[model samples]
Target: MTNTKTNYLFFTGKGGVGKTSLACATAVEMVDAGKVVLLVSTDPASNLKDVLESPVDENIKAIKGTNNLFAINIDPENSAEEYRNRVTQPLEGVASKGEIKKVREDLSGACTTEIASFDEFSRFVSGETEGTEFDVIVFDTAPTGHTLRLLELPAAWSSFTEENPEGASCLGPTSALKSGKERYHTVVNRLRDGSLTSFYIVARADKASLKEASRTSNELKELGMGNQQLYINGVFKAIDKQDSLANEIEAKGSEQLKSIPGNLNELPIRTFPLLPYNILGIDKLRSLFNPDLQKSISESTVAQTNTPHQELTGIEKLAEELCENQQHGLIMTMGKGGVGKTIAASAIAVLLAKKGHEVLLTTTDPAAHIQDFIQQLGELPATLQVERIDPKVETQRYTEKVLEHKGQGQSEEAKKLILEDLKSPCTEEVAVFHAFSKAISMAKRKFVIMDTAPTGHTLLLLDTAGSYHRDIMRNNMNAGRLRTPYMSLQDQELSKIILVSLPETTPMREAGSLQDDLKRAGIKPYAWLINQSLTLLSSITDPLLKSRASAEAEVINTIKTSYSEKTFGIPFIADTRLLPTLLGNKEKV
Candidate 1:
């Protein structure tokens, strides 16, 4: 890919598949190949600066001590503010302040930020940057859901503009839409043209990430971007074949590969072996494509000795603490994608159900598989019910409710406009927020174990909660007597937030950032759960796997000291088909 002449390249897949690392490595490789390259990150939760070890912002800043390489981080918050000004600035003096305020409020959403970032993305692809000196442009996109939405917008916006010339939905006025239509259409064509663009789907050897990569593959191909390639990252290699757990890890990767989704079979596929140590700095980045370099890269990561399992609390103890002799409460497991939030929530839900508590295991993720995951246990307890707040189902329900109540007195033409406006993707936010708010209310009667969507979407839901709280305070006559969902989140007695993450460099940092965001919202996390740590394999004979666990020690200690009041670790278990044995055994705190 570094040697390809393709003008545009995009790295997208499930989160934690090493998308950022791979993208940066590609840029470095291209530069080494003497090709001037520009990299752009469209993820709202971007970590380009951390990966590059360079001070990157909205501007195209050159990497330190490097030539012919430049990068940009399209900050969504800043982009939304700029887009809001662009939209409202024109309406000034010609429109009422009340009308302008309403428009601003409408634009204050995660969806708007998505569209704004899409607009910036199109600017580069639609010939607006044709005269730039760079030879190629590479994009490191957000997780699967967000990337699909971003790619779909060009076609969505083009069709929307052509049909609804007199009206606009979140892309500013009709006049601007008319002007952007051609560019949007141009972007759609550019994406479809195989010679000009390539979409790389990065994944791990796990079923979930591979399944998502397959879905992303078909979705992007349907959007006219069929020049797709699949990269299976972090392939397991057991140094000690005699070790049972290590061989199981290697066997699982092989099994997953043999049955990879059908769609992936059609694309060009590549694989990278897993590294026991985290890759940082430009030198380690180069080691990705060079296995010889990787072997001799560092000896510091390895320890000369083995140690027994260290003393610490586990998930069983944490689950007990969450129940705390209470029947009704809200327990939220929040984290970035691929961090085992669902598993943590499930273990706790089963533990509580066995203890005679009525629990509802739910998820707000659009790509959720809560029911399937729970049903795998063969016979679920009657006390433990599983549900997923299906975004599509909730959106349809919310749309009908709106059309029935708000559209009843309007004319057919007026109703048509309202329905058209509802087609905007932003409607998903309002629909999901309604369901989220209801779930919070249900916790008052039964244990509501919510495995929330990834970090970006959860923050958006929280932002909506805060917005709704402010609206109620400003407009309601009985504000002092009312308690909103935001208030429920802030109440320590009613709600408990558990931060979840893998014991790795990126996941740990992202979890810490999430904790800070929660603190800013006055929602202190009850505890931190480091999922999939190597602590369970403390007795393993493999040197590479042991070193992996050694790296986790530093991160685990950091979480205990710097982030959470209480910390727990869920060890890596090879057999995920069966429920955890720890469920039946509660630990003493």
Candidate 2:
């Protein structure tokens, strides 16, 4: 009933929660139902091209697999370049070269990229881009932290420009705030309208995803985006009560579902069953709503999917390696969200601390799910401390710190310009990066285990850090060389990035892409972790689950061979909180 009514749809949650698949499936469902649909992805690291099996780019083109369906990826880099060129090309004759260069610099970095994407999103939502042609527009947004910020930008900038009439902060040194404020408010209103838009907070029935979903729901509620629903993906129930792994998996989900977090319990929820195979490709996407129509998996098919590779035991060997010859260093668990980064990081932190070393466990997640693990740890006798690098808190602190120091020797006008620029949300990104640097610096004294935000937001922070490194290097070229945050991250001995992902094609590929990005930035990952692997569980279970385990063997070997020099695997143990189990299953092993 609601699908026919709402023209705008938002599928947003923590990463790896099947947002893209669900969104694409919904768009296709709508299209097959005879409504022309336009699906748009706002993720920096989108896999739309792979999922849709089409050559998708920034241009709004027809998706080949389905009729009456169109799609586009809001390529942030391209959009940022276009926006900068569009705004500055007109000033070629009007402004000096140095002035123009400075203007471009102000409009550069992740800030401008975000601004460009927001502009594109606003255009589509406000019916200015491909609106007349499509009956519905589906927005596959970035992970939770990034998407929340993107959604809040319209209201944020609108209020910023309204109260500070002459402020030129949002557009940096250049001021386009006057022209965009009305449109920004219009987009915000369009989003807030329940009749036109529907926001689906998608998540798996786990602590990390649900808590993040709850936080997102409350925040969106505060923003007056009350047209929201919870989409619980991969829900499981045990048909065979004797199967321990299956029973545990089902029980874990059932227990969590019994007590839904925050105001999420208030929202209407739509649950999807846990599928044996991932909803990959166009055919699988089309089968999402009608799973009974999907092809049956034969034993031969399962056998074909299985590989000869044996699964790595657990985090035991990996934690032991981390402790060897390294009493104090940085260990960052970076991954697509919902692939169990939170649990893996927490487990590693606990293990390290239990090994008689002081461990400072922190997270860059805006939701701060790390804080929730404190109760689960239940009085850690080992020196384990948890903290969160809150964006808002850090932004405020950075603003004051800069105002105090930068304003010391500057003239009144220079100080005011600094103050003006600090008012923009761009400053917030810098603040978060500063917090990340501080967290990295702590590694010198103790084992600093950092659980980062989902891939997109973490990449954004790192990109900001790279910009930071370049800026400092340029300014202090002739002066004494100080180690930048990026430089510290690049040092293999100083930092060990643990690339985490599930043993699946898309998640592993995304992790691989992240690893490539890190390599390009001169940061080598210390190890790779294939989390929540179903391989090695020979327990008699459902045919579907058996096939899934067989499927994991291939990806596990791929990750062990192609991804990292030091590879570790964690089995899918479904204890409360989904915490790490030393061995996958003692009896089975």
Candidate 3:
């Protein structure tokens, strides 16, 4: 128990695996034990406000009911703005206004946003807090891919500085970090040193999440931070014999638990049962960390009332609209990871193809699960075709194409530097954006359904698209060439963005933020699809299931009142074979 409250604790895993809930619970427990604690979230789509049931901004504020706990949300936009001002202020007197404007523009990029946010992270981890009074700091990180890159940044920057001390890479001049080298070095040491810092890999009793956690653990170890602990959340057990859905869920969870990746078997592991009620507010949050409370927590169930749950529209209606419109455009399913985007995308594609429309279902996500969806459906309509833009493959092709086409007349020295620069993560981003652009063109002729990566990565990719569009507009100035994929995406009639969310606090907030981001980029979404909703599964009468259903109803009402005008609910099903029938289409492929 003492080891859990290390000086620095990081809660990381795939998205939607209860990282924020567990991290918040740990903070409440430490505060109750009389330790000064600071809890922060670095995820761009943070739900700290929803979890704390209070407003949380960039500044640290004390939790109302806690003795010694404070919280902060390090937002990327705010951090990037501050970082840009900090880096450009000193040059105001030396450089011209035009030069200053160029510097600001360069710093206002996707790569810069990531670097700026990470700068704040390094400072916090290196003990740069103004008070220095907190005994422990806990961080709820973003998804696996984003967090892995964040953990690897110190080493990446160290290598960049060593190789090009006199020049700048994608981040900035190496001299920008002159004064903070020692601080960053200390932060790196704290991260790798087990006594000074602890990393906890939180996951669920599901095959995909367990595999992702195993990969994350191995990657962290390769970065010289080997010591870690694993927590398997949402373990289920059936108490009612006649509850078929509950029994099936229990069986699936048990099977996945037994088959956890072999590499994670050596680490200290813990499992938590699925509580009967949502873990909201301070009392429920704190109960998760106390062993005695956990022993009796599962027995605590929600008391049902006479209120009837609302009956919402389902995906079948959305499918009917697409079929009747007979339009050829882009349909994109996006939200946080593990929120059923792939399933929704595949289902829509199947529906459209069954109606005799040409549909190409492709994905730009590195960890694509479209193949699994196709396998589940067993077959696809002849009009439907599937593809994926493998990042590794596209990067190699993009590099060779650039070397042969753009690097033909360059000097040998220049060519060497070009090759070196092309090896960066930024290069991969550019290549993938081009692949995405190509995919967009296919929508003009046929329906293009894309299942994007997780929220953070997908946003980054879109950021790249924005950047590329600006470059083309500034350089080419031709109307024909100025209309890029970003332009096509912004056309409301040409692209329909479908946001998928779970009936939980974190996923709802994240989906709203994602919708806001899309709107900011000049794109408006078509609808919000609440996937795997429990309220729609009214046949399940078990106490645990009923409690979850009631909790889900509240979130659904919020979604209906606040967000999209068109909101659809998908019922939780024990067997996915009933999907075609659920969609109001019985065309077997």
Candidate 4:
């Protein structure tokens, strides 16, 4: 591994695919080779500090295990606050104090948060900020969709600036329109000229993740930001004869790897063996990072076999519970971004639709991949109606409506401030609540299946539901336009929550948190689906995968006992593409 370069490396994939761990390992490797490295995590629930076993806050701090390695967690909210203050500082002379307060509140929305985070990230990646002297910078990103959206912000911001160049520096829309263009352009130019930037799409050997990785690469290439590599993390082949579970996992993983999507076949692919112990802290990670350990693990994994077929008893039981209440029910799949929640949600929707139920599949995830999967299904029984709830569009419309209603005879300044407020992170909550409410209403008519936002956002959205409902009730009583038709869809009986996760620590922990959040919202999950497990299939001889595969059994059982009346496990497929045959025309399974 060469360590003389100052390239910016970003690791992203489906959630729980070991992106953070791999990023950490890479950073460690670089630091070990006498290079200064900065490891950053943009994910809200980033476990970077935990993995490094160091106390990492928003600022950079030296990592314990290495001399030149440092870690940082970029908090978007803080950055957004700073950005808001900067934008509003110049506006104090042009607008009244009250107007300035309103402008600040409005600028505090989700859009600003996203932009602020991107701004910080760009600074680091382009070496325009401090720590530029580091030999390498590695970023552990959120899921694929969120990361892509975050990366695309500079382009979006550029458009915003072009449309309202003069308003960019001011507190409201007019000022944002006037001065925003220059700020956006500066960031864009920095990104385009950054020759040291590199992106690594991390993925498991499963069909869904591999396909996602290929699609992500294609999307980035189209965007003219295609300096990339492919890292297939956690490739399990098999282990000792006594470990039947290990053998089965390796066999399944090998089958899937061989059938990787055609689009990703040519990319530089690196494989990391599944380690025996959890890759939590620096000590354990260092052991896995050792070249000798990797080689030994690889050899041992390749020499074992005798895997067993996994039981789908949990899924069957869950299906029975779902079918038990023939009454119209709603099942929602929710978690952090890029955790395969959409895939899992679609699987459940398809499974139910095949069972001859009137199923309506809907998603509030900004990056809805379900449509692609559905189209790939070719002709299906029209029993399933898939709809996507776009937060950006919905929020924009809602903001326009609010301005129209509240600023009927106000000055352009007031209207602009209202529009700015509409861009805040809170606006997404309002917009999502509208979509979610509409979805919940549908539960009264047909079986509703939903794919929700990631954990933090989802919780915030749910929390807003109660306040929203109260606000709507009060407004209706006072003769204001009734609440949007979508805000009242939170009935417990009509909704069944399904937490989707992998049989790994991070995802499982996140899934558990999701369950807790839902319960706090007076919503209880109907079941938990553990996606892409190798333990359920036949055994193989790869020691690396064997150990990892065996480890999944305990996690699976834990999920089965903790979540619901039943738990489901979807085995890792041989190919990333779901052939027409597997989608099954009859759908009784």
Off by over 4 Å in 4: 77-109, 126-133, 165-186, 239-267, 287-289, 295-313, 323-326, 336-340, 354-356, 366-382, 387-437, 453-490, 516-526, 533-546, 553-589
Q: Taking the tens digit of each residue's C-alpha lDDT, what string does model 4 give over 172-250? A: 4434222345556665664454366677898988766787898888877766666677899877644465666555556
Model 1 misplaced regions, further than 4 Å: 91-102, 129-132, 166-179, 298-300, 303-309, 409-411, 581-589
Tell me the deviation in Å of residue 576 in model 2. Answer: 1.1
Please state the error at residue 177 of candidate 2 in Å.
Answer: 8.4
lDDT scores for all predictions? 0.82, 0.80, 0.80, 0.68
lDDT per residue as tens, model 2, 304-401: 55433355756766778887988898899998877777777888888888889989999987866776665665577458888889889999999999
C-alpha RMSD values across all candidates? 2.4, 3.2, 3.0, 6.1
Instruction: Sort every candidate by lDDT, greatest first.
Output: 1, 3, 2, 4
Question: Model 3, range 1-589, lDDT digits (tens) per residue?
Answer: 4445369999999888889888899888888887889998988777887787767888988887778889999888787777777777879799999788767766655777787777778877888878648899999998787888888778766565566665344556645542456766787889999887888899998877898899889999999988898999989787675888888888888888899898899899998878876777787787787757755654555445222465777675777775566569988999988788888888889888888899999998777768866766666799999999888899999999988776899998888877766655556676887799999999999999999988978887888788777767656857564678889989878888999999877788889999999998999989999988777765675667777777788788899999989998777754534445445432211
Better of 2 and 4 by TM-score: 2
TM-score of candidate 2 relative to the true fold: 0.91
Q: On TM-score, who's better, 2 or 3?
A: 3
TM-score of each model, in listed order: 0.94, 0.91, 0.92, 0.75
Question: Residue-wise lDDT of candidate 1 within 297-336, one digit each (tens)?
Answer: 6455564434345456888788789888777999999988
